[model samples]
Structures are given as C-alpha cells and as structure tokens.
Target: MAIEWPTTQLEKQSDDPMVILNPKTWSHYHSYGGWGKFFDGLRERKLLATRCSNSDCGEKRLWLPPRCECPDCWHETQWVEAPQTGRIYTWSVVKYPGELFKLPAGTPLISVEIEGVCTKLMSFLKEGTPEIGMAVKAVFNVDNPTNSILDLAWVPA
Candidate 1:
C-alpha cells in the first residue's frame, strides 16, 4: 500500500481510552554538515569511510558511518574509500516496517562486515536471499539518488 497523508481533520477513534488520528504536515530543514560527503559519495557510487588523523590514536580501523571526530582521541577524521565487498554478518526480513519506511514490507535488512571497518554497516538487500557469511557487494542508487543511507544497498556477489 502506498503512503498517503491525511488532508482532513483529526479523526477520533476511541472515547474511553482517548485515541485520535492526528494529521501532521510540516517541512523540516536538515543539514548533514560534515557528513554531507557521505551522502555525496553515494551519488558518485563511492563508499566513504572515516579514519582518525591523529597518529597517536589507538584506533586505526576505518569507520563505515563516517565520523567528524575520532571517538578515541577526539581528533579530526579523514575520508577514505571503503571496501565495496563484504560478508553478511546477520540479517532479518522487515515484515512490518514503520510508516516512514520507503521500501515495502518483507525487505531483507542486513548487517555487513567489511574488512578494515571497525563496525558493521546496516543496509538492505537489493536482490536475492540473505544468509550468514554470504558474500555481498555495495550497490549505489546513483541514477536516482535519495541523498540518504537508503541510496546504498547490498546484493549477492
């Protein structure tokens, strides 16, 4: 089913419990700030990660969700190209997602474990079934970029 916004007034569903369906309509201005490069990389079909610039920092692994500062030393981070290939560490089918979820229900969500990355990147499977230890590659929605994390997906490699 397609998502539709309610244009009419709020509808009261119950009286004893007090429940109502309130229609909300508003525009929110948001900025990715230092993380804008991550979204831009998605459009360019590139996966960007962040690494601590401080030489003294103990953490040398790349961060998938690029950070503006290093968590260890609080130093500045540098952008680096991440490995496109990874293995599905875990997965589950989102049979009943929230209303704001753009994708349809039953979509397979996966946690990818890429080498050199310190953490698992959460993304959806674009095609094929997911399994533990399944090899996968990053696929970008460059043709129709959403400027969001949804623009990145994984497919069986």
Candidate 2:
C-alpha cells in the first residue's frame, strides 16, 4: 500500500486529468565521504560505524546506516564495523493508525544507545518492552531479494 503523510485539513479533490505525481528518489550524499561504503555494507547485511580521527576524541558513531558526518564534532569520519547490538536509550510505541503500511500494526520505533558511545540510532523494535537501557541486538535479513537499511531490524540483546 502507498503511504501518505496526512494533511491537517480537508481539501477539494483535484479535477485535472493531466496531473502527475513525482516520486521522491532515494539518494545518498556522495560528497559526504564514506557514506556509500556503509550503504554497501547494509546491502551485504552488515552494520558499520565511523570513529573520530583524533585518538583523544574516541567518539564512535553507529548505525547503517549513517552518513560520514559526525552529528557531534562534524569532523572527518573513519569507517569501522559496529558491534551487532546495543541498548535502547529511548523509544515510543506508534499506536495511532497512519497511512504507512510497510510498518507492522502497533509497531514501536526504537532509538538505541550504542554501548560505549555517546550517540543514539533509530530502528524498529522487534519484541519486548522498549524500556530505557534494555539490551538490544542488531539483526540482519539477507534472504530477502530486496532490502535496505530497513531490513536491519533490532531486538532485545
């Protein structure tokens, strides 16, 4: 099913027959260094991260699933394989009905805090209460013919 972000107010239906909808093309920022390499890893059913260049900084960024930019220091990023799991720092259950169908019914979207890192990454919670500080693991799906970063779901570790 097609997904639609709901409009706040009712509107008259369009009568123009020639009206066309332009689908948004998914894109990655190539100008951001090392982003594609991380995407390639996701396509291969793996998770990757970026580590800060300065040893003293020692900050690690996790998720696919992410671009090369440091949300914190905005420094040049170096690639590394992330541990397959972490813990949920915060989460909210998406109980309200919506236009999106790819998401399962009553699903909870989770934001995880990577162990030993001072950052959080978002993913779908698979099972159990998404309490803060609960252990979680990154799981991959490679058997599917079509997959993206969404194919990497998270469950309790």
Backbone clashes, each candidate: 0, 1
Residue lDDT tens for model 2, 1-157 = 9999976544434657444454566976444345756656766766777776645555544534554766567776677777777888788887775774477767878887776554577888877778888899987766762344566778877
Q: TM-score, each model?
A: 0.88, 0.63
Cα deviation in Å at residue 56, candidate 1? 1.6
Query: What RMSD value applies to candidate 1?
Result: 7.1
> What does the lDDT read for residue 50 in candidate 2?
71
Provide the global lDDT of candidate 2 against the true structure.
0.68
What is every candidate's alpha-carbon RMSD to the true fold? Answer: 7.1, 9.6
lDDT of each: 0.94, 0.68
Q: Candidate 1: which pairs clash?
A: none
- Give the per-residue lDDT digits (tens) of candidate 1, residues 15-80: 989899977799889999999999999998899999999999987679989998999999999999
Candidate 2: C-alpha RMSD after superposition: 9.6
Decoy 2 TM-score against native: 0.63
